[model samples]
Target: MSTANRSVILAETPTAGAAVWTALAGLAVAMGIGRFAFTPLLPLMQHDAGLSLVQGGWLATANYLGYLAGAVICIAWPPAPARAIRWGLVSIALFTIGMGLTQQLWPWLALRFVAGAASAFVLIGVSAWVMPVLARLHQSARSGEVFAGVGVGICLAGLTALVAGMTAAGSQATWLGLGVIAASFALALWRPFSSDGVQATSMAGGARAPLTGQAWIAALCYGAFGYGYIIPATFLPALAHEAIRSPAVFGWVWPVFGAAAALSTVLAMRVLPALSSRRLWAYAQLVLGLGVVAPVFAINLTVLLFAALCVGGTFMVITMAGIQEAQRLGGAQPARAMALNTTAFALGQIAGPLTVSLFNGGLKLPSVLAALVLAASSLTLGLTARASARSAESRQQTEIHVIRDAGDARTNPRFEMS
Candidate 1:
């Protein structure tokens, strides 16, 4: 069917409004499995596949590279963004299946790249679809209960993988489980994704273009956090068991991280309108730094759990806000700013583990993470302050417009008298 027919059908449906939120939630779920859960499972994947650390690193890098490629592809190809997202989810599912069936380094690497690319499409496309509708549907209570799908999926996926790996069922079982989950979501989205996401597409189109200088600073700050946050996310469990000597305790940490993320996203949305994004970013960064690096010194269960909750809860939201702000700054050219931010973040993801690994060559992973967190905290503060200042100016201008409109109304004596 054509776009007009699609729109008309949606307009006629009693459930149209509700369906939009469901589509949004679906996208969030797909993204969580496709993008966020892999890091926690890497150790198992490496052990089962008999892959060396370097090869595992390469596979992770391939995913980031593929994400970068996918972001560009979505802009260049302009496949129905919703459809692209669904297709990407399917690709992730299939590649994950391939991971289960094949163990040779090159094929796994290629599959991971495909998975990464698919993950990008799922995340960007889905967010683009839902963000604008969320913007209009509710101004004060910024809930994306849909986004919670990500947290839930991540929590479940990591919990499953950690348990499977620990049970000595081997890494393949974890991979198989992930494949089943991903494939199921993929097929669900593929069959009727377009009809489900009508409003999401229209909303996505409102994103702005090339970012302001201030926005770039914000992006850089976010990218820096990406560098720091991902190290623990990708390798915390492995570090917990192998480096810190507590596989059992850290196994539980992954789910805690996911649960915290779900809680944080919901709470953050509720609190979004009350404070400026800058304030939130600053506080969130502080929490994240303290959380991720705390494990460096206190290699205990309590500290590990605390760190997982802090970082997992805040990092993704901060990145999401950064992209949204960039779009606000550069109307119609959001793709460039967002791409720049994502690419920088991906580069950081690529760098974080490799850098930590070098230090972990019989040294300390947590120490490296601590140092990076300190740096991230400092940078985030600076950028948050800058963005805050700019926002104040923008709000001031809006206030001026309101005042001028009021003055014009006052001066019109006829209307005033009336």
Candidate 2:
């Protein structure tokens, strides 16, 4: 290649790689540590801190509520995307570290809530921050690389918990170590998220068209995605702990789950061209529902691992596809639509834990409920697709009628005389 061409390629390569990694770091902390660290840590807390399943449910509920609150705030009072993302990263690190400093249940609850909120901001912020750059670079395919950070973070969290479990490090020390890891990631990400992206004035622009009936269905499906995944995502390790009674064995559950999640996103990115986002999302939900129901019928190690893979594999794909569909339907201004879907998702998360709590650790009931919800949502998407097609056909017929009527009016003698 000529020098000019070689220089251009070199510059583009580094910028693209940097953007991808920055997004990965932000997601790892926001999603893996901020959102899901609770999963692996829950078993430890239950073992050492006298935390009950009901209490664990409550704690999960609190985090979901915080996530909901943060989504609401972002929708209502939009901020600069880059700035919001940086602040979210910092807050996640602090709150995660806070988890280690206190043993009081209430304090832990408060910290989890804040961390949850931070994670939501990070998610939204990362989307708003990274998407525009990718759009400009015409490198949108790399979006999957950025989202894979969630799985990476989850893997790390699981590893941290595993080592702690093996050494009998207890919940307190586990929390401290995870916090340190999160904080280090936060520092390393500080310059990238801070200095790399340009600030958008607001994620949500002025009023856009109202959401369509199909969009409403998509939002509901997004919520169902949250509900369907949370139970397995949160409690799998605990179940593994019960079945295996060895940290080494149970620890593998979460890491495997995370590995599946990370791998799934990359695969989806490649496979998505073959399928529409809506169809892919529906199929994923179907798979997820089956996964949720699997553990109910069987409790062996094999069944549990397969279930974890199901949940992990589809959760992120559903999320990415749901948001993409929102953008597709929302047209120029999708921020509001994305936020609405996210809020719906957070609400679903809140409900999942509460539902689990109500059943008093009744795994079958919650799992069955999740499967039904996923199935219903999948069916709803199918109906929405049909409705959209019918609406388009009706509009086409109406336009043809109007054009013929206008042509006749122009050719009429009465109109010609005038």
Candidate 3:
């Protein structure tokens, strides 16, 4: 290659790699520590702080409510993606640290709520900011790497919890450790998420049209996904603890869950490149539904671990595909579309914990209901994809017919317009 060509390659390669890693880090902090660090830490809190399962459900609901609020705000008045991400990360670090500092239930609820909202902002911000850069660089395939950050973060948090559990450290200490980790990640990411040349244009635009039927269905299915995975996502470690009665044994569940989550995205991209986003989401949802119901059928260590793998493996895949579908359906207003879908998802998440709490910490009935919802939504998504395909095909045929008629009119001069 010429010198100029070599220079172009070098510049593009670094930018693409940097964007992917940065987005991945942002998501890891926002999602793993900010949103879900609570999962692995829940058993510790119950052990050390006398926290009840019902209260835990309430705490989880608080966070999900905050996430819903945050997503709604983004839809109403979207902020600059970089600014949102920076502030959200800072807020998550602070809130996570606050969880370690306080003992009161109310304060914990409040801290978790704020942290949840912050996670949403970061999630949307990362999606909006990084996807455009990847698309521009023709590195769209690397989008999976960005989402895998969630799993990586989760794995690290789970490991931290595992170590804390083995050492007999208090929940407060674990929370503080996670906070410090979140802070370090935020510091590393602060400068990178600052305003850059690759402007996140989606943040500035508003939806021109109301959501279509397909968009609504996508949102509904995404909501089902949120509900389907969250029960296991939130309570897997606790369930494992109940069965195994050993922190060393139970701690491995969350880490395994995170590892499966992180690995599944890369594998899916490579193995199922031909599948449409909606179809992939449908399949993943079906698997997640199975995962959700697995432990209910057999509450053993093996079943719990299998449940983790199933739930963890597919949630991010569904998230990635669901968001990509939103972007596709959003037309010029992808951010708004994402916010809407996220709002639906947050609602589903809120319901999950509340369902557990309402049932007095019961899992069987709730798991069965969630599985049914996932199954129905999966079928709907698959059918929706087929309908969309047929619609697009019909439009193409109609356009082709119009072109042919126009050509005939021009050539024969018999059907010509005035």
Candidate 4:
């Protein structure tokens, strides 16, 4: 369809609601099935495909590297948000199906790498396209509903894996199943993400601003968040399996993790309406740190579940807050800022699994290190917020003084008539 026709259709329909739901479904496929379905399927692959922990870590690293590449590409030469999202979702389905068809590690690595890149594109595209529309419609709060899709996607993927485990299905079948679901979602979303469905005013037609010092700091802290949550996010199911030998029982870990993640975004919106995004992000990071270290004290079902709740609960909250903060600071170039943060985040993710592989899959030291990074980064973000507040206050006070001086001169008639 032509851009004019697409605009007319969007105007005739419930544009805001449709955009939000489309973004939600798109994210579910992108993050849930494309990026994280592998996480839940890892143990199954280990069992049926003889995939060792080291191999799994390598697979994860390859995906993260692909994510980094995608983010960098966005920064260098971004495609239109709608176009990127459409193609990204389609690519995810194709690559994911390819995963099911292959048994070789090299092919798996290649497929996963491409899938990872596609996931990044969808994530950035959704954020770029949907957020501006919501803001324009005076429904910025609805963004929570949109981001909640990530958790929903994760939850669905986990449940599918759980079912597969309970029924003694092979990893290949589960992969194919998720791929089909992703394809279905992509098909449904294809039209809604038309190039002219909703214009990204925030992202389009702006002289891009360079990243500031504080922006760089935020990006680095976001990277810390990526490293902080990823180990548990990537290996929670496997960790639970070690604690509880039953697939039926251990499979609950990922679903619980996903559930907490999905719920937390909505709750954060209602519970902390007054909180600043930076503060919210800092607090979530602290909670995530605790979750990251939870399994280290004792590796059991309870501890693992607690860890899942903590990590899953806060990761999405942190993600939403961090990206919102970037948008606030990005100043006519929010997409670029978002991509920079995502690139940093992807680096952290790459480090996380590599850390596990380096330690030979040991959790204690890696968990402790990740926690420390989270703590330190949290402190930095908190401090940055304080500094920004002070800077604004000082500027306001100076402006007030100048206004007072001008008024006094006018009243005194010493400078007004001259």
lDDT (CA) for every model shown? 0.64, 0.82, 0.89, 0.87
Comparing 1 with 3 on lDDT, the higher-scoring candidate is: 3
- Cα lDDT tens digits, model 4, 258-289, are 89988898899889988988999999999999
Pick by lDDT: which candidate is best? 3
TM-scores for all candidates: the values are 0.80, 0.88, 0.90, 0.90
**How far out, in Å, is residue 97 in model 3?**
0.4
lDDT of 2 by residue, 202-239 (tens): 27664344666666778888998889888998888888
Per-residue lDDT for 10-56 in model 3, tens only?
45333889999999999999999999999999999999999999999
Q: Give each model's clash number.
A: 10, 0, 0, 0
Model 3 off-target regions past 4 Å?
A: 1-14, 389-418
Candidate 2 to truth, TM: 0.88
Candidate 1, residue 227: lDDT: 73
Error of 3 at 307 (Å): 0.4
lDDT of 1 by residue, 188-274 (tens): 666545643443344235333334566567666666777777666766666565654344556777788877776776678776756
Error of 4 at 389 (Å): 4.8
Ranking under lDDT, best-scoring first?
3, 4, 2, 1
- RMSD (CA, angstroms), candidate 1: 6.6
